[model samples]
Target: MPEYIHGGDVYSHAERYGSLPLDLSANINPFGIPERVRQAMHAAVEDCTRYPDPFCRAARQAIGRAEGVPPDWLYCGNGAADVLDRLAAVLHPQNALLTAPTFAEYERTLAGASITFHTLREEEDFALTERLLADLTPEREAVYLCNPNNPTGRTIAPALLDEIVRRCAQNGTWLIVDECFGDFLTDSAQHTLRAQLGTNPRLILLRAYTKMYAVPGVRFGWCMTSNTALIEALYRAGQPWNVSVIAQACAAAAAEETDFARQTALRIAAERQRLRQELSVRGMAVCAGEANFLLFRAQDTALDRKLAAHGVLIRSCANYRGLGAGWYRTAVKTGADSERLLQAIDEIREDG
Candidate 1:
């Protein structure tokens, strides 16, 4: 079994490195938590003594209103990770299809249940293409996809996604689409299939406030599907008060920040382009993804360690399947933070 490693381990790294490093490993909003969300969480502290609404009614309602989906079609979880686990448990898929170099949690969760899964190769830019259709056979119970996928940060083309969904429906396969980073796209609406949730029974849209709202610790995530029975089943599979009061309050306010997503996309799009060019100029193989992050490769597989010496942290793609040594991922943060990372990379290049 391959080891499971994830980003955002600043605490442990800081302890060992003796300095608080700028973490570009986790792709989160550079602006940090919105002001309104901060105030909401502070107010929620007083109510922490009471149990949170297990159904997370208020937060779901806010999300539904914003997304134009019915509240009942939504199910909240401790985080997107929690929701993914619940979906695996409730569906109990005997076999599933996943794209290689994608999120590891899916394989990890399904593996625990002894479920079988197959991976599709992401060659030539790592984009999902028509080749996936041939792999979606009747034997597969489900298909998992990460829009603006982690590590690579590339999104599946909308037209291709439509074809995939239609094919999944034909195969009686559940299409689980994780849009956790969709908000980072400048043209997210065109890419998001949430509007089709009212009609597509096989489509499951997984989303979270963690990245967009900069509240990963709050652990807020929700899923939407037209299949009422499946939604109820997933909710039932979770523990009571799965979303705490603090999370609910913060998520609700964050959801209500109608302009936050737009501003974030605009900011990230510019930075991502600039970062990719700069990295390329430094002789790195930069994958210019549309999300708020970039995946690149240098001749140095030990770049992560070298960057840490400069009080910087980046995601090493060594553990991610389909990627090998010399690959790295970094979030497109604020200009200053990005400059720091670029400076560190420049230093590493000069040292070489």
Candidate 2:
């Protein structure tokens, strides 16, 4: 398996620091899980003895209604990562293209394939631009685009994204755009490619309940594409009941909480701006992002470990390709949680 050491390792931090730390590592919803979703999961415990619907009919139907996609177009997986793994298995592309300093799972899932990196220059603030269209050559059979890209949290402009999609189609490249963090954006619809799935057989869109619903333990995510044959191949790549009954139930309920998602986007917009300004004033090179997290650089390369001592956890982006040490990512938490995070950083290390 690919390295699973990404983040949200509060347990590991607790073990080493001798105390549980507030996790600002994972960009989970600050509002926590919706009450209806929590209750749905609880109500599903009794149904655990029965086999979950292999097709995820009920969950997909509920999610379809919310996401405005047909249930048949959806392919539920253990998580977005799991869907990506199955996708890699089914496509088995000889050559893949992805952005550097984005999600590492793209590299891990396509490990066997020859990979090409389109480095997003830091001087460009890591934002994807028209320059990327040049890399969509015929030689690359598959491509991964992480919207509001991880670590950088910068999204591609719509016109640029359209051109990239057009280029991918011309090259006959299978395009998988990951919009897992789309819910956190104030205008997520602008960044989403859901409307194109019906026309673009080569396009696939991925979404997850992990970050938006704060349900990582459920390991629930789904991908939507109009390519029926590809969807069938994905099912064959994995075993039956890949998603548990509880997870399906949670996904179904969570999909119905549309207002919850809306409020979260609003709150995240405010909180992210607050943190971005604060971090920049503190002498860090903060990337302007609209997501629920901030990616910034610091003089303290060991900042993550140092914060652990003060009962807080943050992600060190040193392992992310195209980035080096001193780069870090922290979730924009609600209320005083962000205050505590800032205070912890102040206590442990000098600002810049």
Candidate 3:
């Protein structure tokens, strides 16, 4: 079988198409980087000769303030993926549980550590239910969950998720929630587990500025937990200076861009709804996700291929364990950009 793939690989597509394509595969903030963050990044170049602060104290402090947690409770990483890898390594679990049709990275990371994991099915539209609680047995060492889960972009309700966390704690299992896309929700605070960190030592909250700040190139993310020993273990397991000087500075500045996140969420919510409605009207089976992207099943054309032929790039979910051909995902871009994607679909349909 082929290896799991991730989105945002526009360079390879550009190479194949002989030109840059409209990249809708990565669910980034379509509003682009904040002006303040851009300036901070430009200023970061003045200090590249020195090694970055391996502890990431300043960045963590900013994030801590924004998240209302102590800086010592957090650990910085190259990205949320790096944190996931570190968690798997520190825990060294023999067995874990995850959801089907979720982020591919979890499987790859767990497998690398020789950790076996089971899967839970969404059944319809990837909706997670309380039945997930049954899988959190004492035998399982850990569980990986993504809030507003990837590809499908659906979020598990906070009450149910809290119950799951309690069960994991009771069963002596670690619950790692990847809230990478949580910032895109207007009511993210109500859904996030950040507040539970102090009470649930086994709870791991993973977050990233890559999507929310539109700074994927920066490769910055962090995790929070009350398990101070786990945080120390993650630090020792990672190389010194895993986060670059530029990334640290950018993240610190990005934290202060409060209005940026709020505005982006508003914009994405509008565009996502618009795209979902349009695709449904066109007879595509659309998943109305709560995040900044939409997933759909369409047979009108080889959606990914047809869109790519017209200089557009979207995610094909056939490789996802629970899904197959005809399933596609596209990021919620600005009105103009999303309209262009819709037009490409129309053009392909008309051509047939």
Candidate 4:
């Protein structure tokens, strides 16, 4: 069997649970695909006979306009993972620093490149501090940071991030910030590093269309960097026509659907707060974060087993570098789905 990545193990969930129930482990939009994006994709299906635009010109232009970056600085990929792998190839850092329990892909991609890695401890709740910044040396070639960090669901303060960026620039270290979940932030622009790309050549920002658009099957994602040289290296290293025609069309439409994006963000924020309140009222200790997911400690491993038995699969963080059996992460799903999970947890507590 293939190893589990992160989040809802679809194959395992289907096999053990009989059928897929509400999958709250993957942090995707609960509302599913938007009508506009679906329509656009369906319309583009007719062009499948022809090859996709290798350059992704139109999609890149749309992304550039939406992100306020030059089109030349953007490069689309099959998914964020593809871009990450390419980054690993081009940067080829000898030593890298990453937050423990952040997205596992950073380490996996770096490991494949034979890169040495250092992990920040979890006692600080995996938060990046000034002392942590001072520990980085010139030998550490690159640093990967996931804002509103995964698994833990915590965010680094903006000022601290600025300081880190400054330090990285001074030491000639590449700072790659994965803002895959940054769209869920109330003030995305304030927290985003895209605007500073030109001024800080050391910074690379990774964005994804999968999570917010609920289009993981389509695999649409891109990376932005002001260094034209790095962008060229990535483009050359990636396969030709990496993104599909349908994915390109759908991702562009989703990016243009400003209203839908705003509504979804608002809905997720409200729903996340509601879920946190409901869980806390039931005696669960939830970790605070800005994304559309919640991380909390279950009373025991029994809760994990019971939830799985009930067909509600959540991410058990035991496999994460710094987490253990009691750690659990669940995405903010629809009102009904969230209620179902809460009810299941309540029942498990009562039974215990």
Write down the lDDT of every candidate, Cα atoms only. 0.87, 0.89, 0.87, 0.83
lDDT of 2 by residue, 7-102 (tens): 898877767767778889998887788999999999999999999999999999999999898898999999999999999999999999999989
Task: Output the worst ten-in-a-row residue range by lDDT, candidate 3.
Answer: 112-121
lDDT of 4 by residue, 68-117 (tens): 88999998999999999999999988788877778888988887443443
Tens-digit lDDT string for candidate 1 (77-121): 999999999998999888888888888988877864434434434
Question: 1-352 in candidate 3: lDDT tens per residue?
Answer: 5643878888877889899899998888888889999999999999899999999988999999988999999999999889888987898777888788789888877874434434434455678877677777788888888898988888897789888988888998888899999989989888898878998899999999999889999999999999999999999896888999999999899888778888889988988888899989888898869999898888854789888889999998888877789988899989999889989988988988
**C-alpha lDDT of residue 159 in model 2:** 89
Count of steric clashes across candidates, in order? 0, 0, 0, 0
Q: How high is each candidate's TM-score? A: 0.96, 0.97, 0.96, 0.95
Better of 2 and 4 by lDDT: 2
lDDT-better candidate, 1 vs 3: 1
Instruction: Give the distance in Å from residue 186's predicted Cα in candidate 3 to where it truly belongs.
Output: 1.1
User: Which of candidates 2 and 3 is the stronger one according to TM-score?
Assistant: 2
Off by over 4 Å in 2: 1-4, 350-352
Off by over 4 Å in 4: 112-125
Better of 3 and 4 by lDDT: 3
